[model samples]
Target: MKQKIAVLGPGSWGTALAQVLVENGHETILWGKNPAQVKEINEQHTNHHYLPDLILPTELKATISLEEAIKDADALLFVIPTKAIREVAHQVAAIVENQPYIIHASKGLEQISHKRISEVLAEEIPEDKRKEIIVLSGPSHAEEVAVHDITTITAASPELDAATYVQELFMNEYFRIYTNDDVIGVELGAALKNIIALGAGAMVGLGFGDNAKAAIMTRGLAEISRLGVALGANPLTFIGLSGVGDLIVTCTSVHSRNWRTGQLLGQGKKLEEILNNMGMIVEGVSTTKAALELSKQLGVEMPITEAIHSVLYEGKDIKIAAKDIMLRDGRIENEFS
Candidate 1:
């Protein structure tokens, strides 16, 4: 059955997911803040700034008005950044009177509150107007997904029906969707892995060999699992797609914005300069701060996240931070227990 779905924020991920919906035969409306970009998506069917050289589906429609985008929509997919999730949810709450399944693809924690994207949505979207909030995450990248690369992702919700519903909505041969009920683990895995990816990219930028990257990824997962478990997430979830799977892809792939940002930082570029040059949100930078805060608050030690935070925010030298991680007192890995 075809459905009307509103995909909010016409960024790379949003545009890519909207394209997936179009292929799924849904009446997809992509919403963006920039009227010029909206017009380009509608008229040219190309988002060159985000997905260059990829032609979007001609049937994939876009609009700048919130009211027009959400009108009669069966589901809403929020693909905006963490900083803007609250504002967008608030806006959606005002315009939406009917309950619609709310889904988010953005992977980052709120900087100030350290809340996950779903938590931010729940706080802003009223229960009456919003149905169950679902999170779609995994090793998938928007660029590859836009070009029909085979990708697998997890759709998680506490409500089994909601997860299964989303599974049906997005499942296809090119894009596979798995359903999970562990929303906490799923969201944490998605957000926390970016910290490790930054470290991985920094390793590459600093000319560290594959051995160093492997060690960082392994230890990074340990720390991420530690902090996630402390926050009531299932430890096993970290080993799943949203956890280790996502960590591997983001940390190793050239397509990851967070890893690329870390690469620039490894090359001694400033954060502001990297952001300006990349012209995209490097989610790991903000996520590092939130993970640092969460680590301190939860009493969970995250050495890699701490090192990345220091390098990105505290003006610490990358080599020195790397050395600090190496010289730390050796302890038995506890994530296994």
Candidate 2:
């Protein structure tokens, strides 16, 4: 029952996922654009650039060549960031004609296009042949996952069979997988929570403790729910693992890039300087821009998202922005409820 999985974009998340597949007795080929990293992974089975201390399992093979990595794989896990997914998808499309069902673990929409990762995949891959697209997402982080820690994630697809199959493919003792039909909601929640996570990070940076974080998380759910409902996602889906569940974990975890990025901002570091030094992918940085545009197009009231956008892009001071939000005219509670 071994699966041939080609994990593309071998970053920390991608490397961790490849590790999981290998540990699960699956044939995994992990590919990266960096030749040095790929060579090291193939030879040493260690991604020194990312997970420096952890040794990759012997079953995992790393490659720099796209053709060699995905040639005979049964599935492709799109683990790249939103900004890089399109180009990688295009490259994969060119190399593989009869390909495996592409599974994406990325968690952001395109900033300029504001398209979901799935939509970006569809645009890159050929449409004539039917493709089974499944998304694996939740609150799991790469660091914990790499260490073989127990974690729960949700698998979603429009097709029930696809979702179930992905669940079977990824489920294991340390890693648990759940199935859901709420693709739109799952995708939206995955992408949007990062922005809110940034907000939560800012709260942490400002030394605002549990009460502020709790308020931000609850209100952030409201923001996601409003926008998600407007975009045709189920209102209640916001309560699921991909929604409020995912939000709670990402906003609070120090491992979160969005939160970390916001932390620097909260500590009065410039966005450009923080981003330049962060090294790893901070998704909420770009996701904030995408959500800002999406909110405008959809006419959703995303106050937190809007505030974060202002701070990140418009150079609005966080202190002033926070004060402005607090000073807004009082409104009836549970208006959406």
Candidate 3:
């Protein structure tokens, strides 16, 4: 259809997605706050700081001015961190004139409100200026997607047509997009899996084997589905691409910042030091806090999330936290009661 799309945030994921859109023959403009990075993308067709060693498509344009990027754009794709979503959405809301399809690739609940990204977007963007928000999520890494590796993801919206539109917009030979109507499940799965990924990485750092990783991931899915269902999400969505699929990729892949952050923690590095050095947002760190709060408020017994929260925020030693999780009272595996 050759639509003009404005991608906010020139991080690894945003740049990779911008590459996909430009290659799909859309007028894709990537907007970043950093002038240096924008200049690099425009002049050299590369974003070395984020997607290092990967050359972006020449047709992909980059800009520093948000107004220039969104002017006359048919859609706006946000790929920034979770904490930045509301601020960026507020900025877009103030200036966006056209009724563009509001789409977000970022995952994580709002820490203060425990609201989903779409919920945050809907709260900020006036109803008259945007269509139903669509969330793009699944087991995808920016490094892999930037190189055209085979990848599959889901575009979820309550409005079926909106999901299908995103599916058509991004689908290609190497990248496949599926449509799901469970926005709640999709967004929760996408956010919660990162917490488990941190745990999986911590297991590795603590010298645990595949058995520990498998247990954390399995039980983590149980916790995620429990909270999600309590919040009105379809239980079936937890097993789909955005659920278990995202869990496997993020927990096992080296490209996951959350996993890497947990690994550093397991290796005895402090959170502040690890985050300062990583130079990328580790979403699970903040998501752990939000999930812990949600668990307490909803009376959801998420032992794993609680354990991770204790380690991350309560100054509990990772070893003791792991031991505590292992020693919790055992119950029947599949009892959702």
Candidate 4:
């Protein structure tokens, strides 16, 4: 059955998902803060800055007003940045009269509190105004998904029905959704992979061959799962799409802002300079800080995350950090076994 869905955060990811919703014959309203961009989406059906080469669906409407976007929506999909999730949820709580199914596609951790996106939403939004939160994540990129490239992702929720409901809402010939209950593993996998991607990009920047990059990705997965399992996530989820799959794509793809940031850093560029030029958020940079802090608190060793954190925030030389990561004491490969 068709329903009204409000997609918040009119960035590339949000806009791409809105295009899919429009194709699915749903009443999709995309909300953003920029009046000019909203006007362009409503009028020209194009978001030149984010998805420059793709034309948006004419049937998909957009607005700058938050109340107008969610007043009558059946579901609310959030694709905003991690830092903005709490603030936006608070704004939604203030005006929303009806309870809408909440779904999020953002991939990062809260910096100071070290909370996941769902935790942030649950804390900010009153229970009466929202249903169980669902997180959608995997290897899918907005640029590829916008042009009908085949993509598979996991829709995870503690409630089985909620995950299934989200699966049905997003599934299509080009887009496949699988339901998983390992919300913790899925969310951590998505956020933590960005840290590895940054390291992978640094490897490339240092002119390392494929072997070095593969080692970074492999070891990166080990530590990510270590910290994740310590926090009560399913160990097996690390091998799934959200884990190894996301790590590979984000690390290798030119589309990943995190990898690109690392690449520039490896080339001896400054963080401030790279961020100013990218025009998009590098999630791994922020996630590295959060992951490093969380790892220390949890007593889990995350060498790559620590290295990236040092390179990004602690003024450590990128090459020296990479060398330090390699020269660290070796351990049994199959610690999980």
Candidate 5:
């Protein structure tokens, strides 16, 4: 039962997912924009730019050409950054007419339009050529997923069967998949939690212990649930794998790009300098802007998101933002579940 799966964007997540598919007996071709990444995956059997230590399966091939990757594929997994989704979708639109089941592993809204990744795909891909849209997200980090470690993730779509199919596609002894129909909730939770992770990393960088990190994580989830609920997603989704599960892993794991980015900033690196140094997508910076915009538009109270926004966008000092949050008037927390 080997199916052809094309994964666009051969960064860490894409490479790891392709590994899972290959191990599961799927023909996975990972498409990378960078020639070196493509060469590494095809020749060296490892994407040195992303997952340097993990070896890729021979069933997993890499190509720089989008046409070669998507041309006769059974499934298409969009593993690119949120900022590049629309542009990349446009590149593949003509080739995507094959109507392969589409899966998105990206977790941020478009910075300019404020549209979710799913929504962006709907706009970029031709309506007549559309297929089932599925989202794969959870607390699973690429670093752990690349290795043979236990990880649980959610496969969500409005269509139950689509979710279940993806769940079966990736599920294995080391990987557990849960099915959910709350696509918006899953996407929103995935996008916004990165912002919270930044805050948690700031706490770590500031020498705040476990108690402070847990509190920040809890409050950060509350903000995510609020905005998600306002936009027609199930509130309870914030309690599940795509929500609280994702928040915990990203906030605590050193493998998280969002958390690491914030840690550097908390250690006093300028935003521009940090971005230049990483040379990869941090995701949280754009997500913070999108969440801040979502809060303003929906009139939701998200002080934590706003605080992070100020630190990242307004050039406010991280310490000043921390003090402001500490001094803000507080009240009893209400469980949204």
Candidate 6:
């Protein structure tokens, strides 16, 4: 079952996924806007800027032209940042002729509309040109996946066939795929956990112990589930790989850009300075704004999200934000009550 797959965006995640596809014996083309990076991947079999010190598979191809990547491809996998999704999808929609399975691994809600990535994709890509959209998400990191470290993730779609197809498409000895029907839950869990990761990193930056981290993570899950359920997601899905699993990895791992960004903020660095230096997308920063807006509209009380939003956007001191969360009116542990 060798298929032609186009992986859009040549960042660490996209390159790692493209390598997996090539190893799986598929024709994988990685597309990037930067000609220099595309040339480096095509000629050197390495993406040094994103996955430094890791050489990509020799079979993995890179391209600068979107039309070249999409032409005759059986599937398109998008791994770009949230902000770029609609623009990229629009371009893809204009070029793609044959029906292909549309898949996305990027995590975050649309900042203004609070739309899920799949929702945004569906809006842009006509149904005639693609099958049901599948979302690949879980606790895996690009750096670890690049080195063949054992990783498991979920491919979720309302159409079971699409999910199962993606499951078989990416599964290998080191990378495992599970299928779930709860796309809403899966996407939300993937996006919202980055917010908690920021809080986790901030806790470390503030010199707090494990107790603080544990408290935030525990309560963070509560609010995440609360908001997710309010938005029509299955409550049980929150305990699965995309929910609790993603939360654990992103919040605790040093490889998480959101966590690192929060750590810098905790260390008293300004957001603009940290973002300018990081050279990667800190999705949690934008997700925080979207989550805050959702919580307000839905009347969901998400203290951790609100606190992080204050610190990141409102210029509130991290310590004071932490104090504010701690001093909120005590309620029962169950947020659904």
For model 4, what is the C-alpha lDDT against the true structure?
0.92
Candidate 6, superposed: residue stretches over 4 Å from native: 335-337
Candidate 1 has what TM-score? 0.98
Per-residue lDDT for 1-337 in model 2, tens only? 8888899989988999889888888999988888888889888879877887789898789888898988878888999988999998888888885658889999998978998999889889876433688889998888899998998889989888888888888788888989988888999999999999999999888888999899889989999999889888998889988998899889988888888998888999999999889888888889888888888898777888888989999999998877777787777769962
Clashes of each: 0, 0, 0, 0, 0, 0
Model 5: residue 299 alpha-carbon error in angstroms: 0.4
- The sequence of per-residue lDDT tens digits that candidate 4 reaches over residues 24-62 is 999999999999999999999999999999998889999
**Clash count in backbone of candidate 4:** 0
TM values, all candidates: 0.98, 0.97, 0.99, 0.99, 0.97, 0.99
Sort by lDDT, top down from the best = 3, 6, 4, 1, 5, 2
lDDT of 4 at 83: 91
lDDT of model 3 at position 153: 95
Mind giving the per-residue lDDT tens digits that candidate 5 earns over 173-239? 9999999999999999999999999999998888789988988999898899999999999999999
> Worst lDDT window (10 residues) for model 4?
328-337
Enumerate residue pairs that collide in model 6: none
- lDDT-superior candidate, 1 or 5: 1
Model 3 pairs in collision: none
- In model 1, what are the clashing residue pairs, if there are any? none
Q: What is the lDDT of residue 159 in candidate 2?
A: 88
Tens-digit per-residue lDDT, 236-329, candidate 3: 9999999999999999988999999889899998999999999999999999999889989999988889999999999999999999888877
Per-model RMSD to reference: 1.1, 1.3, 0.8, 1.0, 1.4, 0.8
* Model 4, residue 118: C-alpha shift (Å): 0.2
Residue runs of model 3 more than 4 Å from their true location after superposition:
none
